[model samples]
Target: MSDEPMDAATPAGAEAAGLAPADRPIFFIHTPKTGGNTVISHFLAFLPVEQVFPPPPQLTLLDGDFATARERLPGLRFLHGHVRVTLTGLLPLERLRLVTFVRHPVRLVASHYLYFRHMPELPMHQAAKALGIADFLRRYPSYGTNPQTRYLTLALGLRRPGVHQEVSEQALAALEHFDFVGVTERMQDSLTALSEHYALPNFPPARLNEGKASRDEVEATEAVLRRDEFLMRLGADFLLRREAEERLEKWFATRRAAQARGALLQGLKGAAAMPWVAARAGDAALSFLEGWHPQGWVGEPRDGAQYWWTEDRARIVLASASGRGLRIGMHVVETLGFDPARIRVILGNRLLKTETAPAEPGAEVSFRIDAATFARHRRTAVIELAGPRSATFAELDPATADHRLRSFAVRRFTIEPLED
Candidate 1:
């Protein structure tokens, strides 16, 4: 498939994929101010104007006449709006694919503040302008935390009484169902990932509903945020964003590797098999960094590629189908605040391999256990990693003084099995 997004004006993308554009419903769960406006413009290009839901006004979530709109519009397939997740016209959930984009919580909150300050047409926006950000948050605390969680999980249903933790887990669980999820920070990367699933057009967003805040203003608001509280709020959203980033990175990497080897279809097939890579909550293997012991690893995903941070030792257990002589492999890089050190890998007294960390940041170390050694623990193994020096986030940066001890994060860990 072409890396370029589909021309929104034409049905080329759908046609190329052998899908009937008229009947294939693509639901846009438009979260507020996350570069969705630009996507809407592209969606308009190919889809007939009537096929889109009730004309998205400045406030698009207006509830009324959906049944009427479905009856009126013939060949409705693309619906983009502020409404909750839903569809109609004999289209089942499988036929309809859901899509949405996410932004950083702090940035999103800051942008929302400025947006309300500038646009006072809406009663809530006018009221929000009168109240400062802190005051505004006191009333609507969801903005700072997992606002995306609420939108994705609770849409169409009234909220049952539950704490943020419960809500967050549910939201994260639900996020796996989305066909394509994008991140605002990496717009082009997100589009690239989206293209892998659907034919997206090259049309860049007009950058609609974007608000600019000076660094000082953003910093001041950030300072007011309680670190723990802010983290709790951004928890579900952060996970979702990290998953999106990893997917995009892996897509680009796979495409590059495939192009070099003249096996592009094989790369596409890998991504297709695991479209909801990080989103799956089960024990099944999916992505490179997944299937690690949850308790030992550092909290929160670090950088575009997530890894299990380890110093002296880290244990990760993976389940595999009955197979013989599976080759064990893993990818690792030096931590931000640590010196390059050799990583010692062991599986039940069997020294699979010891790999030296890369000299530079972008460079990585990939080492695999010999087939004979890997076969010993082909079903499951308590893999271990050891290094000389490790540092905490607080020690690394005084400005962000987080006290958790950290070490090298793994970008990929693989157990390649032979099909017999």
Candidate 2:
């Protein structure tokens, strides 16, 4: 029998090599040491040459902000860089389809150490010279300190604080805004899912470091993995097991909502009344506009009375004397996380420590503002509720109402004079 082309229609055979023509170019944020090379290599094989751009020389920093770059290079898709997701604001909220991979922190750190050892410019040896295994372990928090470290820690849920601090709370908040998170331990499975999502051909195998180390060396390094309590805590804290994945999924959703809100505020350029008005008209506008408006407005009636503003910029105070206190409640929610330096609290001429009045569960406590502090700060105060117990009035229901208490005071004030 003559050799014939294998049946192309067969269901069991390997699929054709290369992605479909209709597939859009994917923007890959190639976080370092997380199988980024493998992803790039596989993607390059199928993607058009123009679609793939080498990461910037910095490796850690992409060429420009994703949004601005995307605008300049339209039809630009598929970004592979050792950059943070927040830095790449290219993907709009609706269009974003984020995918990232994370490895075990120990493995990641080891790989990073070995990679840096070969770079003549990097002072890896000098840094490690005085540092023994124990010293290295103690300084492990430093590993996850910068953008690179933060990117990996948040993506993988690895919380080991190296000599470098792990990911900052803010960075973690940003990473949680993703749609899909692929664990590096399960590279094949993750790649398969990624291929289907992006409609690509086969995924190439990962490139392992060729440098050889003695069994003793390997054992020594692996030993660090076991003794490090922070690494262990990180693993437990992330809850990487199947059950924990569900919890992470829920957390990601909440963070995504928060990120979307933050993005909206950051995008606003001026005191454009129309945009604010439109935002206010929308459903749940009070919550969205909370801590947002310079000049506050009264919201709908609840309980018995309408929510209204009692003071102006010179001496501002929002109060809900009656009704459900929903307006004041919404105000508190917006002000809770603001930085203190951005706002000042004063009563008449004397500045008062911005303080929150504690309220019993399910009971409404009237909020009192010091006029002196308001005046000293020029009627601008960024209210923040600190501590584990203080619950925003909006979060107060019959169930969690007992947890509500005053925690922090806003001290700093950023005064933006009303434009002429």
Candidate 3:
């Protein structure tokens, strides 16, 4: 909730415990389509790139000789992958802080199906496209089965068992032992708890790689996923307990504060200074908040023009102008194979404007955000750009290695105060 940055050198409550978050190696088991991309991306931002094993674009160490790689990479602090828990035995379990997230089985499977269908790179894409939901579930038991339960069951090095009426005791016990197991349904609370438990930065949640499947399509598969359904409840209950513990700890700390009156006075002073603070903050340039690549520039800059690609739905945050509206100009280099790239600009929940970029390269478009809309959002305006479609370079060309789904090549963006 606090926009203030967290200090990496001094993780709260870590010194007294004798082990800081950085001291212990963390293993993040990223289960697919359960907000894992958002979770992993935020965590990765806090750690040294080299220290994170099998880094981005490379999902798991299991793809290679993990043992050899581990021995060579002595500075490894974080290990993340779409890996089963059993593979984690390859690492030093005593020194590892295990983490994962689980979603409701029905939703998880449905999402997974839809994601595969959308992405051409996935092995399941062809199958998902060719077969109906029922046929796909019937044929691909590996996915339709209790994947979460199976993955957790691997914690005990147990072979993945068939779907049952209830979850296995060993699997349930393994789930209980994880350092932090979040629930996707309650992601905000889960992320808050994760930040508190791990002494990590509380990055606002970013929704990525999301897709929807019809209820009828997803519901039919639930009968085969009963074990995971059971495991999901346990995961949710576990998160609830952790949230309760965090609340109690905060309450105790609040009660013990001897400077309550001083704190109140300080808060009042801060409140009084907010107007000046907002004025100063209002001059900041727009920021890419979500659905954009961290690496803003790709390839060489041409003619003093640096371009950034936007995902299908990208969000940009800008500070509100004082008593005036903002005039925004954007240069679009590429459209979605369309003569005119249809762009929907949204302010908060309201559709502010719809504009189109010409097929011609470096097509420039301009729009205005009225002052009243900015005022409605207090001091900040979050603008969402919904593009027509997204495709990867590989999708366009077979030889290219880039697999990121991108749309709208934005050469440049300019924001200025509109004169009344």
On lDDT, the leading prediction is 3
In order, the Cα lDDT scores of the candidates are 0.56, 0.41, 0.61
TM-score of 1: 0.55
Q: lDDT per residue, candidate 2, 270-292, as tens digits? A: 32322222212111121222222
Question: Where does the lowest 10-residue lDDT sum fall in candidate 1?
Answer: 275-284
lDDT (C-alpha) at residue 349 in model 3 = 66
Model 3 agreement with the true structure over 1-420: per-residue lDDT tens digits: 667643222223233345545567777777777787777776776777877877776775564546865584457777777764475447655455677777766667767777787789988899988976557876775666566666665653545565543444544555644667777776777777778676778877654444655665556545544554434444432443345345444433433231332232233345422221111223434555557754344457555346667887776656543535777767777667844336777875687664555534557666787777666655456677877778987898869988988877676677778777
| lDDT tens readout by residue for model 1, 1-420 | 679855222244345666565466777778887888777776665556767765554436455655554465446667667764433222233445567787776666777776776776855687666776777777877666677666766642324224355464555555565666788888767765665567656555545554556667667766665456566667766777777677666566555433322221222235333322321112223232222323332356565446566544555443333323344445565455544445566566666654454533333554453434435544334455555566666686888876666656665655455444
Q: Count clashing pairs, candidate 3.
A: 0
- lDDT-better candidate, 1 vs 3: 3
Candidate 1 local Cα displacement, residue 202, angstroms: 1.6
